[model samples]
Target: MVRYVVIGGGIVGLATAHRITIDQPDATVVVLEKEPRVAAHQTGHNSGVIHAGVYYKPGSLKAGMCRAGQASMLEFCAEHGIDARVTGKLIVATDAAELPRLRALHERSVANGLPVDLIDGDQAREYEPHVAAVAALHVASTGIVDYAEVCRVLADLVTKGGGEVRLGARVTGLRRDGATTVVETTGGAFVADRLVNCAGLHADRIARLAGLTPSARIIPFRGEYYELRADRRDLVRGLIYPVPDPQFPFLGVHLTRMVDGSVHAGPNAVLALAREGYGWGRVKPRDIVDEVAWPGLWRLARRHWAYGLTEVRRSLSRKRFAASLARLVPGITTADIVRSGAGVRAQAIAADGALVDDFLIEQAPGQVHVLNAPSPAATSSLEIAKHIVARFDE
Candidate 1:
């Protein structure tokens, strides 16, 4: 029997394993997760937004995958009795300069073949009354779902489909023998006919272990968020976003109505000192050292120093974060928010200081490595898995 190994049991890894088992029933699959359980990193700590493929360029990998993955995720949720819905989101343009960007976004959405409604000032207000904007693009299919729960269900599906999911199994090394790829982990060595590296944070390292030189490096961008205090939750009826600056990759701070009825805001893009750092207190010295030593880090810093500094300032000041929130919803105040949580974005950067805007992958003799899968990756997890498998087949 053919045996396959999937590293990283986050959403991407779990979903990949799930697809493999479903497609090849008789094949043996093993999922190795470094953490004690699944979804410990990006998947567990994401915005939980089921993206509607609005922010990407038409025909880009992100656009295609998010659109298809949105539908597949909903179907998988319904089949597994998961909680996911199309609560919809509004991308608001509050000022004159942002208006053109908003219009361009609407056109891009249409070009991507996504369902969208272009709303005027009054029409936008009708959808989200408290949301402040001159015009907006309403993506009716966007929604929120608990990705951690979905990861659990995917783990269960993999097991039921006769696959083994090994947790706390950190991959330490890789070697290709005559016919099988040897994966050396903290637990032991496992040999498989093929390997898949879906490590969200450490994907590049995993690729190098398998003897493939990936061109890009994973730079961590921490996205800090705050939850509106219970008393002020009503300020947001649903998701509210800004007309993201085209120059930078981040979509700016905005309000998101979570599935649990609470509202969250702010996710400023700051360089993360630690790959898994979720707070000011969670910095990892090794991760910090590695980032500083990378040329790509220096390049990005030199180019976006001012923006990066601004994000750092916002990270330290809750009042500043609330001010950004006020741009989208004037009703929000500093007192209305409590430091909810934060997530690290694994942004892939090139050697020349350019941010990798599209999905990047590298393949070796016996392994497939996902170098970059940020932003809507949680939304595009299902489709990405299928794409990875297709590449492996080729």
Candidate 2:
């Protein structure tokens, strides 16, 4: 039987291993996660929005995978008895300047084969009564779910299929002995005929450990959020987003009504001090050194210093953050929200200083490395698993 070792227990890794168990039932699949539980990092800390292929470029991997994955995710939830609701979304244009971009986004969403409608402010108000907008794109497929629960189910399925999920197994080193790979971890050493790296924030470092020079370096960007006060939850019915700034990868601060009926708002993206940095106080010297050493980080900062500064400012000031959110929902005020948890995004930057927009996966003789997967990754987890497993055939 083929022995496979998968690193990281995030949704993608667990989903990938679960797919293997289904496709290659006889294969011995093992998942190694440093954290004590699955979905501890990006998977658990996200906004839980099931993306509907609204923002991705037409014909891109993100657009295709997200579109297909949304259907698969909903199906999986149904089969597993998970709570997933299709509450739909509104991409509002608060100002006239944003109207053109909103219209362009509508056209792009149409090109991506999404069922989206460009509606006027009056029509937009019908969907979200409190939202302020001159125009909006109604994306009916966007939804929300508890992804941590999904990952838990995926882990259970893998174990039920005779696979093992080794938690608290932090990988320390990697070496090859002919066709076999020896993975040394904190838990114990394991041998694998094939290795998959889905290490999220630390993926690039894991690639280097496997002796592969990845095209880009993983830079963590902390997204800070605030949730609306319990009494003020009625201000947002579903999801309310702004016409995203096309220059950056961040979707801008908006409001999302989570599955638990709480409205979360304001996730301003700032350069994280460490890979898993969730707040300003959490910092690691090595992560800082790594960012400084990478030429791409410097180049990226030079190109978008102003945008970066704005994000930093927003991160520091709650009032500023609330103001940005007010543009989408006029009823929201600084007093209406409280500081919520944060998530760090593992953004990949190329040597040329370009932000890797799409999902990036690379392959070697007996290994696969997921270099960059952010945002819609949770939504596309199942499809990403299929895509990764299909690589074995190639």
Candidate 3:
């Protein structure tokens, strides 16, 4: 039997198993994933940005891990022959009303130890020749990479270190077996001395299956993106973003340059009726019922109904979505964009309607469960795994 079983074959789980193999060479470790490959969900579907600890509150796990993760990620990418680049990002304010919030965000970035440059409209334009802004904050460290590649590297190291990665292994139930745990999966039964759960979309459900109550439920938020037509790609030289609404969790639509050298201009954040719902073409009745029946969700809607309504409008109407994206990249129009793809963010909401703004991990005598890991998770995966193993020492 393996000494440890890391559930969820996403980057975190793979990283966790890799760490165990490195530290506990004699202990057998295995990672069980439901999909046929690693990083099939949040990790693979990410925007691949190396977040610079800009948006997080200082001293929290998000801030600490993201800061450490940025360094670690750059180092790993350099050492592992990954094609990651430090393409700097801009947080732009297109109107005077947003300038104050932009300044506050810059302050927060500085507090989090990120070097930020405050610039006027002219300086902002210099960073991205086509970007629009009354003022902006240039964060030089924010970069982009294919996280799917990072996950692959972690899996390779884990397996070569004597850890096993079992794909197509859908875990169905969990029960304590004497001093060990029996993880029942669709592939077969696997027993281990300890368990770690990092299931992204199904995190809460998996926690409840293990007899733990995660204070929040994983509410899926679908971010629909659009790619600029090849002819308009030059219109965006680099990343262009808007001053996010401080009251809400979603960062508004903006322009982003992908690692593939293509420019994507979109991502309207809207509530997804289904957890894995990628398109308006897909829906799960149970997912919708669960969301609508939650009092906390209703409370959240009441607090931001107007914004929510607008998000739906932008989602259903490409013209409105294009206009929102045009706030930062004025060259874009409805005709200049086409449907690219969508990524589902596993946003965890509390019973009290508050968004869990930081990473949440819980531990029992023989298990650890990551309940909520928000944005920058992909950037912070390796660092997060290091932290997870360190917790065992505590």
Worst 10 residues of 1 by lDDT: 359-368
- Candidate 2 residue-wise lDDT, 68-130, digit = tens: 999999999999999999999999988898988888898899899998999999999999999
lDDT of 3: 0.86
- Candidate 3 per-residue lDDT over residues 45-102, each given as its tens digit: 7677888988888999989999899988999999999988888889999999998899
Q: TM-scores, in order shown? A: 0.98, 0.99, 0.97
- Specify the highest-lDDT model's number: 2
Look at candidate 1 and give me any clashing residue pairs.
none
RMSD of each: 1.1, 0.7, 1.3
Residue 302 of model 1 has an lDDT of 85
Report the candidate with higher TM-score, 2 versus 3: 2
Ten-residue segment with the worst summed lDDT in candidate 3? Answer: 247-256
Model 1, 177-237: lDDT tens digits are: 9878999999899998889999988998788788887898888888988999988888888
At residue 108, candidate 3 shows an lDDT of 94
